[model samples]
Target: MQKTLSTLTNNWAPSSLSQKVFLAQQVREHEAAAAQPCGFSMYMLMQRAGRGVFGHLKATYPYAHNILVLVGVGNNAGDGYVVATLAKSFGWQVTVAALNPHKVLSGDADTAQQAWIAEGGTIRPWQDIDFKNFDVIVDGILGTGLKGQVRKDASELICALNKTDLPVLSIDVPSGLDSDTGVPLGICVHADCTVTLVAKKQGMHTGQGKTYTGKLIYDDLDIALTFNKIAQPSAYLVSYDQLPKLEKRQANAHKGNFGRLLTLGANAGMPGSLRLTSEAALRTGAALVRAYCHTDSRLSISIGRPELMLTSDGLSAQLAWSTCLAIGPGLGTDKWATKLFNETMAHIESEQKTCVIDADGLNLLAESQHAFSTIFSPKHCVITPHPGEAARLLGCDVPDIEQDRLKAAQSLAKHYNAVCVLKGAGSIISNGEQSWICTDGNPGMATAGMGDTLTGIIAALLAQGMSATDAALYGVCLHGAAADIIAQQYGQRGMLASDLFEPLRVLVNPT
Candidate 1:
């Protein structure tokens, strides 16, 4: 039997709703086919979309009586018309401002437009309207089909709407924003709230998308299950709920059972980075953490952390003793740092041990001429690189890396044959076959030593027997969630990297 929309949604799991993310093309191409399984046509889907937006707006702004619906020549305009018709029916003062007042819409869009006109709704050119007179603006100027830069007329209309202080509600997607990459095509509508239909787009949850898409509300329209069955998601959006839980310790479990992590770095003048990494590893439940640094760094790195086994000699012995390795926190590119890095890489490759390479280690690897496969195996290696380091490793510019972070992370993982955590606003974790975006961090985590702390956390998870991909996924989400907790309490400014330790510990041992 064909299930009803309410029946499907009632059984939908919250975790699945929040976590699955798809590409713009996937949704555009598959939505109609997906709707069919639920006995809905494209026009029926459009009607539901319009109804959802209007219902949400009514609930959100109970007193908002006057509204301006700005629309362009596309299916998006059809959605706007539907909203306008619904508003007029409800006795609210509504105006439909068309970017092209004379242009005709077709198919499902045409049906929606005709219905609005039949209901005695009028359409005016967008330029003729005074935006200040309206209580709210409904943005239906463009949809997910947006290609390249926005045209001048549409761009000017979007700019005018943005200039207004009145709240704006966007349907499908904020016009001018790339639904796939989350980047703006020149200028995008800065909506106060966006009601995205169908499945969640990857772009909406990351990068500049977050800035443009204010409070996001998803209406699957009861077809997400059918859509998901037809298409695989580009990436999963991970949060605290999706993190891998650590197994409870046995009463007889000893320190050795938890695993040891060896963290290398802190050459001469840069002791704090090493300290942050080593301490983070400890806080993340590494049974024992050993810090191998330059002789001058030993005292400073171990000053407050007596539990850390510090050493300046016997690199081979330290590497042998630890279950996993985290390299590159304060590791410089000088000859001494290079020698240690090379030796460690050689040891890791030869022993086939699990490892994390971050910061300077990534920088050094970028400089190395050796093939990535010769140095690291995908099964046991994870690389965490911010945009700058990722650009260096990928031989590209920072803008190029940020252009499509998902692609950049996947490229790094494929090129290096290891799990890649491309760190930034939606830190991406990709292992070629699967990808995830960490949606928990804040801008406050931009401070120094943050990457170092992340390196330690991932290393600890790896040492404790998580797979390379699982460790990176869990570590990145945990790192960001911890930062969010701190930002809520202390605010983002002046938030130190070390501030995450308490929350990190608390989060990893989730109740």
Candidate 2:
């Protein structure tokens, strides 16, 4: 009997829902364990993978009458052959295009290829066919085993596949893409959708992998629950939905019930960033949000936001009253900015107060590693840096940081001895030991003042009794979730950083 969709949903739900990400090598080890003495055969596993891919493809593209299956030299090809056989059985025109005519298949892959041949399926050399004739192309060229750039012939074919504008369904990790790092080697297949077998590859959700592996689909092939116990996840993919709701406030509680948060930024011409930060803290439920800007900026900043207790002279008093501090939203690297940055560092290091450092504050840190190491303590600090800021802090190129975001975030956290929030497409939140990726937020959040807003949000969460790590993770998720909601209403284009304020308030309180 053909399995119902319920079987797939029931058996496969936890694979994606679970908070675990296995590296490529870890996935190989898990698969090896699954094929052991008491477990299923590699052939059986391949059969399930092939069937799963075929089922998803058939359902997704019901009108697609012609399928061009790109087969390589490995078990990935074995899966493709099985797909062709199934498609032919369903009376659809199927063509298996061989990318590696010289390679000899072995083990379960050899068995799978023979089954297709026995069923009257003819395999054609890649050079013999034209891609324009097919309705949809199936990419099974390279599996997770690929480490480097694709070979010459495959690169040519991949380039061709990409140019056709046809909907390509990748069987596993897209050809030439690092299944571990998410960096595309030399050239990679840009698939419309990728059906990841076994478990979701760690690379598929991060870095450049997000662009190549569109519409990621995971099929665990009915592995027993014990399969998950084989490896501890390298990291968890987190979202706002998974976080705990904040406790309801007491009716009689006053302003001091929630903690006080102080923001230090807004040099001469840069008042807007700090203003956004202070307001965001208030919007996120800080009992009192204060801003200490340059004496010159106080009048302009105080005009619109009277709720913020803007002060310049009593820096010591404000620092003492504040439970949490957020520095660097608009703090430039000028003389005045440097003095304040130095003072904030001294106070936080001495008191071990929770703090979030972002924007130009990060720049000041990158300017002198010697000065930074001398002044700061990671005990209660959270550093938020975009790729450019991270590159500066690490003394590396932006591409180098982007190529391996997880590593960069972890390295940053360890280097600063604090929680690191590496903000980008898939923001990585790490404290050296453990990490989480916040897969929320939209391209609309690419506006100015967004980072400032995030600084305030995280600082507010910290002021409200969250640990540095929890506040970073929860704040990143909430910030992104709020932006996502605002994007839906305002559209991604022309969306402002301030649009997140109301939605953020609703998210924190959750009425």
Candidate 3:
């Protein structure tokens, strides 16, 4: 007997099952080979996928009697057909709408369609249907096989669907969404819930996919363990649960036992940026945090944070005292900023100290004349860059970086020979060889000073004896997770970067 997805964690996948993300091609190429090992045929897998979608729909919207299943002519359409059949069996009013009623569907998709017909169901043209009558919409149109922009007709249909208030449940990958890059081919179905089958598509968790795929549910159809064994994941999805646990301090441990972190930045008028970075380092367990800023901003930075040791002199001595360094924040592109950034980079390279460079530091690095490989040690450095800064660093347009963020992040890491945290909707951390995407965080974090906070967190972790890769991974997840908590409590709107400090302190000491 095939175990239904309902019996396995209420139609939702366990973290272990959903952690590994694969490209659309990997899933298409290896799904059959993976299924064979479990003695399941392609049709059997299709049937299970349909069953999973139906089970979840029923559970989520029990009162939804009238459903419209929007389908294209592919395996995704087959899944929709299965859902229609199952809904019909359960005495619900199910309507399966096909983009082209005359187009032929071969193989298992055809088999599934025939099965739906056998169940006395009719396939209606999407144009003729009244969407307002349906309680929920099942999107199965143009799954992972979508190659380019959606055709004019399909685009119209997707746009029409988006305009409706009906609750949408997308099958496999969301229709018209690129399952690999998370970019929409043209316009994608804005699903309220996406029940992904086989393996989680890398796209659904990041980029524009996050907006389109609302509440993501993964159902492996009982073959994910087998599928994962066969396919090499392009990247891994990271969350709060996967954070590296900080070791408990010994009873005798003092301030000096943790680490010394020096945060350098805050040009003439940007005291808040430096303050946020230094405070974040303090919250993340850095023993002693020093703020080395310009004399113009010293009073404002030092007055509020009495815990911070503020200094305007002794750059060489501060660099020597610090176990880890976080530079950039408010460091501008002026002569003052340039001199500090150069001295800091030189010190990091010569002293072999771990450092995190963000904001103006990244800008300076991008504008640097020396080869990146020679000036920085890859193992001891981390760079945090938003899409614009990343574009500058890579000498490409923002669209190029956003088009394929995973590739861009890896490129940044490889190019700079350092761990790169590509900050955006889905923050990606990469060390060139391995990559992880943070699934936490919300729109509230889009405010100013967030990047500075991240730099501080990463530097603190590095100071606390974590490797550059581990620090980047842990810091990115931690920063986002903290913002998620803040967003939940105070709402996403009007949230501040300084708001994260309290939660950062709480989360870093996770019990």
TM-score of candidate 1 versus the correct structure, residues matched by position:
0.94
Per-candidate count of clashing residue pairs (backbone under 3 Å): 0, 0, 0
**Per-prediction TM-score, please?**
0.94, 0.93, 0.95
lDDT of 3 at 78: 95
lDDT of 2 by residue, 78-164 (tens): 999888888888899999989876677998888988999898988888888889999999999988888667789889888888898
Candidate 3: minimum summed lDDT over ten consecutive residues — where?
Answer: 2-11
- Estimate, for each residue in 308-388, the C-alpha lDDT of model 3 and write its tens digit: 999998999999999889999999999999999899988887888889999999999999987768666657899999999
Ranking, lDDT, top scorer first: 3, 1, 2
RMSD of each: 5.8, 6.6, 6.3
Between candidates 2 and 3, which one is better according to lDDT?
3
Candidate 3 lDDT for residue 231: 85
Candidate 3: residue 265 Cα off by (Å):
0.8
Residue-wise lDDT of candidate 1 within 427-505, one digit each (tens)? 8888887888888899999898899999999888888777787788778888999999999999999999999999998
Error of 3 at 457 (Å): 0.9
Question: lDDT values of the candidates?
Answer: 0.87, 0.83, 0.87
lDDT of 1 at 73: 82
